[model samples]
Target: MTIYGSALIVFVLMALPLYGLLLTSFQPEAVIRSRDVQFLPATLYLDHFRSVLAPGHIVPIREGIWNSVVVSTLTAAVCLIVALPAAYALSRLRLPGKNLMLGAMVSVYFLPTTIFLIPMFVLFVSWGIDDTFFSLVLAYAGFILPFEVWILKTFIDRLPREVEDAARMDGCTHLQVMRHILLPLVRPGILAGFIFAFILSWTEFLTPLIFTSDIKISTVALGMFRSTIDIQVGQQAAAAVLTLLPVALLMIVFQRLITQVLMAGADR
Candidate 1:
């Protein structure tokens, strides 16, 4: 009961802001600007959503959404493609200095991401891909790959080697075993990694802010909702709610698997 109460408290604390944001998104601009704060609006307003989708807006929300979808999808795919094989090697194969390499990867995850921003931006500039989606995907995938590798490795480590051994005895090669057996069993971990990679890439702002000028992802575009003289609170709130939908939906759908993966990682 104590633990359940504590969990409920934590959920409310975290959800209060989201609830307020959702309410504000549906309130009129006039209600938003009013001195009185209404937890419940008198009437639902659709103008904010319309304004957000309206053409010739200062923030190209449509384009931003498109860019975010493409970049996040690409980043997730790249991380999975690279992480799976790397994880299999790390977990299964006998490799020298494997522990050292794993420690180094974890260390990278701990280091402040800010330190890499300038150097990465400069590197991209030198490579002449500074303002391109390619740069955004590359940067996001680089930062996220280590975590993906660790997640997949954790899942792979938990699997029984007897399965792989059996496959090998039946003339199945490593590639065949991975394709037919390992991948199927580790599907949960793979889904978790892909969803996480997509979420991280979708929510990432700094890399996109530095790497691209004209190409704005939803995160950067949301930041553009503010200015010195005036802030578009209504539209911003609507956009925030909209931008949050995909992630929210993903979490709702995969909450059980994600929680299991996280618990497993914590145990490890």
Candidate 2:
């Protein structure tokens, strides 16, 4: 009873903001701006949506969405490519100071994003890669790779070494063993890591804000709802609601996989 009650309370706390955001997105701008607090709209008004979705609107929402998809997909792919081999090594090989290396990697993941921002920006500038999709992908993948390594390593550790040993005894090369034997076994972890890396890249604001000027993704584009003169409350709410749709859809479809991955990590 206590657990159920606590869960319900937690759900409401998390959901209330979403409810308000959704509600405001549909309410007329006047109702939104008025002093009176409205929990429910007297009538649904969709000018907010029309305005935001319209071409030549203040925000380049359409372009932003496409850019976000490209950046996020590339980042996830890069992270996975690097993480698989790194995870395989950490799981299968014995090395001097392996534990220390793992600890250092995890510690790096915990460091605040701001710590890397200026340094990464300057480095990218030196390389003449700033303000490009490749730069964002590089930065995002670097940040996400450590977590991906840890997740894939957890999945790899759970597997039996005998399978690989048997494959080797049958004369399978290390690469072939990983491809034919281990890869199929660890698909869930790979997917989880990829999804998470994608999510992180999609929602990242500060890094993109600092790194790119002409190349704006959806999260940065959403900031167009404000200016020196006014804040378009209704349009901003509408944009916010739209910004979450992709992530919300992802959560709905992959909720179980995400839950399982998180539980596995926690249990480990």
Candidate 3:
């Protein structure tokens, strides 16, 4: 009973804000502006959602969404590519200063992003690549790569090496063994890494806002900032919901795998 009570309390605390946001998105503007708590409403007012999707907005929702998708997809893909090799090397080979390298990577990821902003911005400016999707993707990949590498390394370590040895004995090269065996086994870790990386890239606001100057090149997250002042509260709520919906759905689908990944990582 105590455990169930604690779970219920935690659920309510966690879910209250989300439930409120959902309710507010479907609420009348007057109710929102008036700051009245209408736990339930007689009818759903969808004008806010309509306004968010309506044509002729300063922040082009479609373009911003496409940009977010592109940045997030590219970030995850790049992280996966770079992390796979790095993780395999660390897991399988005895590399010099491996622990130092791991600590440095962790430190970089743990440090506040603001610490790198000004210097990275200047560096990008020098290269004339500031404010481009390529720049944004690269920035996000830098952050995601370390975390992905750690997750993949841990997972790879957990994998049975007997299979790889058998394949090697059967005349398979290391690359062939990895291609035909190891990757298929650690599919869950790869998927978890991708999903987490994609979500981080998708929801990133400050980095994109600081680096990007083009309105058309903005992400859905950055677009929210621009629209917040001009739009009604309900409309803002609707936009937030729209941006959050995909991520929420993705989490719901992979939640079990993610939980297992976390538990396994903890054990390792």
Ranking by lDDT: 3, 1, 2
- Local lDDT at 24 for model 2: 89
Clashing pairs in 2: none
Lowest summed lDDT window (length 10), candidate 3: 55-64
**Model 2 misplacement above 4 A:** 1-8, 215-229
Write one digit per residue (lDDT tens) for candidate 2, span 1-268: 9999999999999999999989988998889888989887788899988887787666666667788888899999999999998899889887788778778998899999999999999899999998888888988888888888888898899999999999899999989988999999999888988899988888888888888877354343334433213548888888777778888888889999888777887884
Report residue 241 deviation for candidate 1 (angstroms). 0.9
Residue-level lDDT tens digits of model 3 in 1-268:
9999999999999999998889889988888777556777647889887878776676456577788888999999999999998888888877998888877897789989998888999999999999899889988999878888998888898898999989989999888888899989989889988998899999999889889999878998898666687877787788888888878899899989778777876784
Stretches of candidate 1 exceeding 4 Å from the true structure: 1-11, 215-230
Cα RMSD (Å) between model 1 and the true structure? 2.3
Model 3 sits at a Cα RMSD from the real structure of 1.7
Per-residue lDDT of 28 in model 3? 86
Where does candidate 3 stray beyond 4 Å?
1-4
lDDT against the true structure, per candidate, is 0.83, 0.83, 0.85
